[model samples]
Target: MINKIRLAIRNDLEASAETRQFGSGWISGFLALVASIAGLLLLLSQRYPQWFSMKELALIHNQTIFSFVIQSILVIAFLLALINLVLRRNKILGFSAITLVFASLLIGQLIDPQEQYIANAYALGFDWFVLNLLLTGLLFIPLEKLFGRLTDQPLFRSEWREDLFYFLISSVLVQIISFLSLSPSMFILETTGSWSGFRLLVAEQPLVLQVLEIMLLTDFVQYWFHRLFHEIPFLWRFHAVHHSAQKMDWLAGSRMHIVEIVGLRGLTIIPMFVLGFNQQALSIYILLVYLNATFVHANLRFNVEWLKPFIVTPRFHHWHHGIEKEAINVNYSIHFPWLDKLFGTYYMPPHQWPKGYGIGGHPVPNGYWKQFLYPFQKKKKTK
Candidate 1:
């Protein structure tokens, strides 16, 4: 049994390794394997919601049929890929693929699925989790393929699993983060978002102006917090987890220390509380931040040339991640580059990109838990 577990882990490692080179055949096989596992696990997730998050499942349209179709298509794809891999004598991948099927079957039998859906307020919706994974993969995977700036960077880049763990944790604990981040502020401020005076002022402004005001106010607060993370040695340890991604991609941004996430978000929203932005305006800003942050971290090369000065683009942010000494401590603005320019920290080189990414000498330990605990670990004493 021990040997079998070892073999399974070994094959998965081999399959993961092979995915980095990403040959057409390997890509198809890998996709098939992933689809199968995702599909089956999703099916089983209904029976065992505790195994993974499904909080958003209730929100999906035509949940049951949609799931069945997703699973069926993926299972078919997996079988085809399995046949292809087996014929080609790709044992490691074949082993991994087959293992997923068996494990899914075993788990399905073990769990007694409910006769009807029981809505638990706090249940992790596996359906939601699976759908989120599928949507992001489908959306960004294609974009990275067709328009990547770092063209040679593979779908399965180094430390992908580590970052993936971070992604999963953040997504699963999303509500928790919201509660935690907002709770302290809510407690202290106790300012009902209805400051009638500020609300009237906000109402008087054009909708566009309200949005611009919130963006400006929020970005101003975030800029200083972002800079604090960089400038303070203690905070740098936490922020460095984000910079540890040697390769930048859509998933890279999710690799944040929980402290940084909670602290930054908690603090950023203070202005919102004080200024009393309308619910609609706040919602718009949240939506914009969600998409913009992801786009800035993505592998795609496309950045609007004209907007580089006024807005934050992938190029604008990638330079911030650059390992180059000159680029370090530069480009601290999250939304507008003009803040960086205003602060005298802006350092964009004309007609050039960073030679590489990540901290120069400080290498972060790979994996979620290690990095999470790293900020608190004592520094090694060198005699």
Candidate 2:
């Protein structure tokens, strides 16, 4: 059965590749240039601090030079390999562009000209980067694989322009909202008070016990937030944009509406605000969410019948995304199987998988702005 599933996946990927024409070498060259520039910046920063002004160095300090370099290398490599399976689509370019932005931010964070080597010492440290990388890989890759499988249908395939625009608009909107909502107290609340309770609760607990408590509490909050989107009509309009995706991949996870992201993150922040989770626990939770959410939506096929009843698996969440009559409004839990089981939203048959997955009723707009304004517009009947 596993071999057959693998064969099916391979065939699907091949079909997708045949339909999509990618510019592999062009992407590789672009990434190579980024890598070279990153390398040069790192070298120059280390070699000639005297040449740069104090402000210039401070700007550089905030940017993560090494992380950018590593990111560029990974992106370039991924694009080269990606062209073999997918079209020379904007999705790959979009990833590269976003990575570049993030890299720039990391660089800025690292290159404190005033502090110089001190900034570099802290900025380029291997420990945090390694932890982040491991966490990201563990969470996103598997989810990407699951999304791939769920989105086997051609209609679900993503359009680059639409996605890129949506992401940009959503991010900007969220930032604006955050700014408007900000105050001195709020700012302090956001940074300092966010995770205080969690820390105090688990301060005396063993490391392993703390980790378990953190995961349980975090997942409990996420599960309800997810279900609320479905149960609440107004919120569903915004979240339906995410469900509109007919196809799923790593980028599928990125297709969320801006408002949805803000709302979800806002809700998640409450626990941090009230509970007082430390930086380390919060970091671990972030890592777990990134990996678990991505893994559940990824294209990888693995059967874990024994584990299914305990922890949420790809098969479990895939069923949530499933388009079948029975699958809709079920499997609301994000990480734990018991949440769904306890709530009675779980719906996996003994020997069945969903034929497809997507929002059944809505005809969501394709462009970012269109979707952003979609909820505001009167609902039109989907064909």
Candidate 3:
């Protein structure tokens, strides 16, 4: 049964809408599978909080709202799976979902009231992963569906599995990444203790002002850092993995090399951390950057021509991934388009997007592991 279910899923992943009709229960089955898996993961995280859950999210674990959420997800999964079982010819997806629902229930029954979690050096961000996935998916999926630039693009577009894997890896390892990314700034701050007065002055400013200052400073640092990745052959290899996406969507931006993620975060965050931005301001900036980055890479078509000059938009960043000759090495800033204009690398045609995305040759191989090690591989020499 397990083997059959696995094979069915593998085949379904490769099948398109043309092959699998819309009313053939596949959509319900897919949703059921997703909910079941999510429910199971949440159950495990609740059972083994020390290893599977984030300490920061501990307060919400036993909350009535959280428990209600888990129950609702499980109920929805069961109903969808049952509906699919009644409607679909193949029972793999439906049966698999039902089996998972039962498994989660079994785990839930074993939860102890006295369960205690010890402090540890490391923990999986499964809790964070679940929340991030839910929040981002709920917010962007609907927007993309209603107003997406590429209306015909399916939710499960080509290479979606690879991008989803990238998203999972980054979120699951958030703890390690945060620690390493911020370590450099923390070390520098500890050594250079004379900047307290300056830092205090910066921190005392209004929250709105601090956020704007953060945007300006970080964008400037990111502008050069992004350009360096394009110009340098070695760095270009790492950055090429990002541009290798043939389709543009919210998930596309997550397809970055871990090295680049660490390096970029470490460098760009130096100013924010060293300058001692208020924690509230830093939190706001972090949220803004998250939304802004996702928005720029989204497959949405908003005619915000007036705002393009002041802030970066989907059109501006799309050109960076454009495969056309004109799009090569342009639009490097994340928040502001003016930096690109100042540096003379900005390229945007009025009322135009790219013919297509990705490197001209599509040199980067598919899959997460291959792309991760691609930069280190020796290139072939043509005689």
Candidate 4:
């Protein structure tokens, strides 16, 4: 009996090894494809600048095929290191290497020529990446450890590559859309007017007051739109992709359907346009929203028993992604807790975390484009 058990364990290990090997090969192939396309586009942009159009050339210039190549190389190296560490059961070295890579990327970005990259690369570095890494490591790391102890599931044990792939694809799509949509007059209108308004708003307010106003307004809009997505079945299908994530983390927030992303942005901008908030206020608002949204979805735990009634913390948003029927359509607020409280949708019973996450029954396509068109597809028969 003991010999049979040993044999079974050995077989399981072998299978797991084969699976990892397959996944690594797949990732390598995909990266190669990305590199090839980027290289071809770069060559075309250089040799046939007139045929390619200014925007097309700018896309290549802004992302700089070089940056993508570097990122891909780093990702491959990290994956190989991770596999070795995992097989050797060396958690400390694994995490240390991961942190080192992230820090190195940040340092590289900081020193790079800002003009070589798109606006978002700079925005990502200064506005989102640095603050998030610091906050996550300081606050979230311990919280995740605590959660792991309680739940028997490591809060941070999620597939980072999947998250990275989603980001790369979405970013590529966004750049393509921007290139196709570019109009000098429209650019002037968006940048000059909206940014000017954002600046003026912050200029008049105290720093603390400015932060408060930005948080309140952005969350208020996000709450309503989030609820709308749930209430309307058609919209729900697209939004459902977000809820489909079986695991939650800071990067999990990027799983949103492309249409939902564009739609939500359009919805959020209405108030910004009509009210005319200055660029500073807008900048601060964007920064706060991105950070808070990342915070709430992060693999963190906070013993803020008193604050739960006011702010939308990780505990609150986890319930929003809860797999249970009663938990569905609850906890809609993005930052503010009062909105969900007012609507009576907030559901976080004491001493309980959700059994699982994702839609209870409905399954969706996995491919990017298929998921993009999912809302328009015929509904599958629900079990």
Per-residue C-alpha lDDT of model 2 across residues 170-202, encoded as one tens digit per residue: 432432434333333256566775456655875
Across 124-195, the per-residue lDDT of candidate 4 in tens digits comes to: 111122223335445655566566323444322444444545654554455443333333324455756646
Give the 10-residue window scoring lowest on summed lDDT in candidate 4.
Answer: 121-130
Model 2 C-alpha RMSD vs. true structure (Å) is 10.3
The CA lDDT at 281 in model 4 is 70
lDDT of each: 0.73, 0.56, 0.86, 0.59
Where model 3 places Cα greater than 4 Å from the true spot, the runs are: 1-4, 13-15, 18-23, 111-114, 380-383
- Which predicted model would earn the best lDDT? 3
Look at candidate 3 and tell me the lDDT of residue 96: 86
Q: Write the per-residue lDDT of candidate 3 for residues 1-383, one digit (tens) a residue.
A: 66776778867655677755777788788889889988888877677777777777754676778777788999999999998888888767888889999998988887742245564437787878888888888899899989999998988898888898899988878878888899999999998899999999999999999999999999999999999988888888889889989999988899999999999999989999999899999999999999888889999997688998999999999999998989999999999998988989989899999999999878899999999999888643110
Report the number of the highest-TM-score candidate.
3
Supply every candidate's count of residue pairs whose N, Cα or C atoms clash at under 3 angstroms: 6, 45, 0, 9
- What candidate 4 gets wrong by more than 4 Å, as runs, is 1-162, 174-203, 380-383
Clash pairs (backbone) in predicted model 1: 53-125, 53-126, 54-124, 54-125, 54-126, 55-125
- TM-score of model number 2: 0.62
Instruction: Please report how far candidate 3 places residue 304 from its true position, in Å.
Output: 1.3
TM-score for each predicted model, relative to the true structure? 0.82, 0.62, 0.94, 0.61
